[model samples]
Target: MNDKFFIQAGALLGAVAVALGAFGAHALKAMLETSGRADTFETAVKYQFYHAIGLVLIGILLQNCAVNAERYYHWSGYAFLVGVVIFSGSLYTICFTGIRAFGAIAPIGGTLMIIGWVLLLLAAGKK
Candidate 1:
């Protein structure tokens, strides 16, 4: 259940990250560079990749860890996914739209990601 979902989600996210990275580097490179937003695009890709990896890890942990805390990992996996979407997704949009206002949405995603990490930690502590 959680295992398959998280693993599949992670794989999909990883593939998307790769594609997005390439798109940014080649397709949007000129535009982003001209707009001084190449770094922003890279940052979005980086966060996506990082959290994609986290999803994979959460999947593995949820599948194995016997801490009676599958719920924590479950939610953590979801948090990571949502965080990537909100955080990286917003940044991606900002780069394309030149709307700095979207930047405000990133911190909410960051907070979700942090909560996900804390949930993972709590998962380990369960008896």
Candidate 2:
């Protein structure tokens, strides 16, 4: 995707993360505590927020930097987006639905996040 897309997505995701965090803390607090998934929900929100910032940074880099590996920035942004969706999304689903099976998908998202960082590093190493 383009830099603009990444910036918009990041901004939107960041907003959603904030809203969800507040909802979890206020509205869903009792349910989350009852389900013993409050920490998991917090984790999801934290990671989503962190990676949302990362996505914004990636977009800014793509827009302002003159790295020889521009394509890596694109891929890295995509990876971060997908990773946050899958990883944080799955954790959210598990917290809400009490389905442990979704935990299995988190690793894939974590891996994608790692790959995104590695790609960013590769891009930094180039030109």
Candidate 3:
């Protein structure tokens, strides 16, 4: 894939993270009356934003690096995207909808995050 695509995706995810964070603070404040749940949701948003920034870095690295590590970078980007959607998305849904089913998906997202991190490590280790 093109570096531009990853950059754009990263930027978009970053913007979304901010929007979701704000929404959780203002709009969902009442809905997430329990402080613990609100905190958990906020944590999810924080990690999502961090990983989004990581994606941007990977995009930049892909553009500048002499060696083409497209596969690793692509996997990292996809994992991060999926992780954010599942991890943060599930938390937001559970917080707002009070649906217990969303909880089951949270682990899947967390696993994605672990995989993303491992991919990043392997990418860095590559010669």
Output the better candidate (1/3) by lDDT: 1
The C-alpha TM-scores of every prediction are: 0.94, 0.96, 0.89
Worst 10 residues of 1 by lDDT: 59-68
Report how far off residue 50 is in candidate 2 (Å). Answer: 0.5
Model 2: weakest 10-residue lDDT segment is 61-70
Query: By lDDT, is 2 or 3 better?
Result: 2
Candidate 1 lDDT by residue in tens digits, 7-85: 8899899999999999999988999999999999999999999999999998988877775799899989989999999
**Sort by TM-score, best first: what order?**
2, 1, 3
Which one is best on lDDT?
2
- TM-score head-to-head 2 vs 3, winner: 2
Error of 2 at 119 (Å): 0.7
For candidate 3, write residues 1-127 as lDDT tens digits: 7777778888998999899889988987876666458877887889889888988887887786536466787788789888888998898788777787999999999899889889878877776
User: In model 1, which runs have C-alpha deviations exceeding 4 angstroms?
Assistant: none
Clashing residue pairs, candidate 3?
Answer: none
